[model samples]
Every structure is written in structure tokens, then in C-alpha cells.
Target: MGLLKGIDPILTADLLWVLRAMGHGDRLAIVDCNFPAAQVAKSTVTGKDPIILTVPLPQAVSAICELLPLDYFEESSVFYMAPQDGVAMPPEGNAVIDELKSAIATVSSPDVSIAPVERFQFYEEAKKCFAIVQTLERRPYGNAILVKGVIGPDGKDLKPN
Candidate 1:
């Protein structure tokens, strides 16, 4: 088995798919363990409609957010999500969240608003994105939707963080 340097191993397949689907202005959604990804993501490459994936949600997200070259996407559309309930963001994702925010911000098209969606709203948004990865993470309200923005053709190349 091979690996993408710096990306968590748990992200392999989903991250690969994310890198493949997203281009400038495209989007990827990372939902909680309980979130339903199969219902939202683009049809699988294998042509299987009910394919189930098992992995850590945030790690998968962070992996793609951490490594892929930013040659064909937007910066302003990149976002992180958490339940809009009054509680603080899930503790387990704090470091991952922080790292993801910093990494995406370095991009020129990063989303200006890192908005948090209410539980039900997040579900609806998932249906609209390019794909969603249902994580094994059980943290409450652990959801993030990263809108793909164009990677400037004239911008400098990116290295894994």
C-alpha cells in the first residue's frame, strides 16, 4: 500500500476521490460519523451506488486539505463546519480544525466566511456538494463543507504541509 505524504492514512480513498472531483469552484463535504454520505456524493467510480466507506472524517478532510496541489480551486469557498448549537466545537477536532483553517487560508481563493450550519441545514448542504465522506468520528456536529475554488494558473506551486 502506498501513501500520500503528510496526509493521515485514514483518508486514502475518500481523499483520492476528493482530489479527483474538485477543481476550481467545486466542493467536498465532511460530515459526522452518523451523517449519510452515500446519499450525497457523486456516483462512485466503481459504478456502485451503495458503496460504503469507513474512515475518520476529520482526518480524511484534513488529509485532502493538507496535501493536494492548489492548482485548480478557489480560496474563498474553502470552509470548516461544526454544529450551530451553543456548545464549543468538538474537542477532538480542535487541532485538525485549526490546521485545516491555516492550510486553506494560505490559498488565494479561500472562503471568506467559515460558517457553521445548523444540524438539519448541514444535511441539506451535503446533498448539494460534490461528495461527502461519512466519518467514523462520533463527535457532535463535526461537519465541514469545502467549496472548490480555482487554483490560479499563475500562482506559485504548493507543497504538502
Candidate 2:
């Protein structure tokens, strides 16, 4: 029932296995409840059902960051779903986005780029990810994708040559 001391309870054994199985440069999509996760997941590398987490966006991101390193090889390691109308996010959505950003920042390298992708583009990209994780976050556009990075023998993020 219990995992390692610092591990978040939200991270189940199956989720941990997925994370461990992922290689550097693989992608992990963390999507909101409204996201068509089941449909998109079918097209992902894993070609399996999404790992569902009954937690808020920020909480899920924080827990995942504890074990998954963000890819430094890419120009941007994190991508969030952008508004379809190109308008600013609503106050509630912005708040949720802000919290998720903060949570990712706390665990990721300072140089990690967090960018936004168009809604449709995000969906396309999510379909290419290694796996999808559906969270109970209800805020609009609360979807993000993380590029996995490697930890070198020195126990630090592997930098590109």
C-alpha cells in the first residue's frame, strides 16, 4: 500500500513502471478531465489506456516531477495547451495554470522552457507521447506535456553535447 517515504501516494506502482520504462526524449502527457485521453491514448507509443489520477493539475504535476526529469535536449521541455480563440485564459484557468507552472518550476531546472501550444496541435502532440495521464483537473486548457530527460551517472540531468 505504501511506497517509498517521499513518493506521493497518487503515484501508483503502474504509473511508476511507466515512468521508469520511458527513455530520454520520450513524452508524457498530463491532461485535464475534459481531454479526450482515451481516444488520444490509443494513438500513443504505449497504445494503452491512460493512467488516471484523481487529483488537481498542480498536485499531479508535482508528484510526477518528483520522479520524472524534464528533457533539456529540447528547446522546450514543457508545453501547455493554449486557448483556441487566442484569448487570455480566464481567471480560474489562469490560477490553475499558474499553480501548475509553479509546481513544475520547483522541480525542473531553471532553464527549462515552458511554452504553449495551440489546442489542436497539443492534441496531435499528445497522441505521439509515450503515455497519457488524465487528472481530475477541471480548469479549462489544463493540459501539459513533458519531455523526459536522463539522469547521468553523476545523478544530474544529462546535458546535450
Candidate 3:
């Protein structure tokens, strides 16, 4: 077990390494069980298998957000998979995303935007991520991409000089 204090126990060594190694602007995909993680992971920056975590989507996202600084440079640093119908978010998806938004607000700015990408487009975006973390969430569309940001020299979020 990691001896690091205040770190979430859910963040295993492999996950911690991935989170720490990713540079600013690099993306990390947290997808549901139904996502094609292996196929998408092969094309990711790490070019490796997905890191499987036995937790629900909200739990996984909360843990990751605790340590991962979201990109403030981009217009929308976080992205979720939009529903196929494109009219409204499914109830399950809405619940998950609402939780995600609250989790992110704690780490980053309260105003940090979480955009939605079409299903296929999200897969394409996931491929470009540095790594993928597949959670044991059974609900559909419980998938998101988090862009890594850096801590400034002052120990705060990086911003324009």
C-alpha cells in the first residue's frame, strides 16, 4: 500500500504513476465498463492496456480529481460522452455527470466547463488521451475525459504569466 498521506486508497501505484507522468494538456479517459477501453487504449499516448478499477464512475472520478489538476488553459478541459439521441442526458448519465461536475469544482474552479462530445467523437478523443481508466460502472454514458494541468510555482493552478 502507498504510504503517501492524504492520497486516496483507490489510486493504486499504477494509477498514481500515470497521473503523475502525464504532462500538462495530456488527457486521461475515465470510462464505464461498457466502453471499448482496450481498443481505445492501444492508440493512446501510453499505448498500453486500460487500468481497471473496481469502483463506480462517480467514485473513480472523485478519486482522480483529488490529485489530477484540470487544465485551465483550455476552454473546456473536461468532456463527457453525449447521449446518442443528443436531446438530453439520460438519467443515469445526468446523475454521473452531476457528481462529476461537483467533484471537479472542488479541485479546480467552480466554473470549469465540462463539455459533451458525440459517442464516436468521444472514442476518437479517448484514443488521444495519455491513458484510460475503466471503472466498473454499469450505467451507459458514464464516461469522461480529463485534461491534465500543472501546479504553478506558487503551489496553485498554472495560469498565464
Report each candidate's C-alpha RMSD, comma-separated, in the order given.
5.5, 1.5, 1.6
Report how far off residue 18 is in candidate 2 (Å): 0.9
TM-score of every model versus the real structure: 0.61, 0.93, 0.92
| Structure candidate 3, residue pairs in collision | none
Query: Of models 1 and 3, which has the larger TM-score?
Result: 3
Which of candidates 1 and 2 is the stronger one according to lDDT? 2
Best by lDDT: 2
lDDT of 1 by residue, 9-118 (tens): 66556457656766655556666666666655544333223223465544555556654444332333545556556766667657556655655555432534465566
Candidate 2 per-residue C-alpha lDDT over 1-161 given as tens digits, one digit per residue, 9 for 90 to 100 = 77688888999887898999999999999999999999999999999999999998889999998899888888999999988775877887788878878998888766778998988899999999999999999999899999999898988878877
Collision count of model 2 = 0
Q: Relative to the unseen true structure, what is the C-alpha lDDT of residue 44 in candidate 1, on a scale of 0 to 100?
A: 32
Two-way TM-score contest, 2 vs 3, winner: 2
Write candidate 3's Cα lDDT for 105-155 as tens digits: 876678788998988889999999999999999887889999988888887
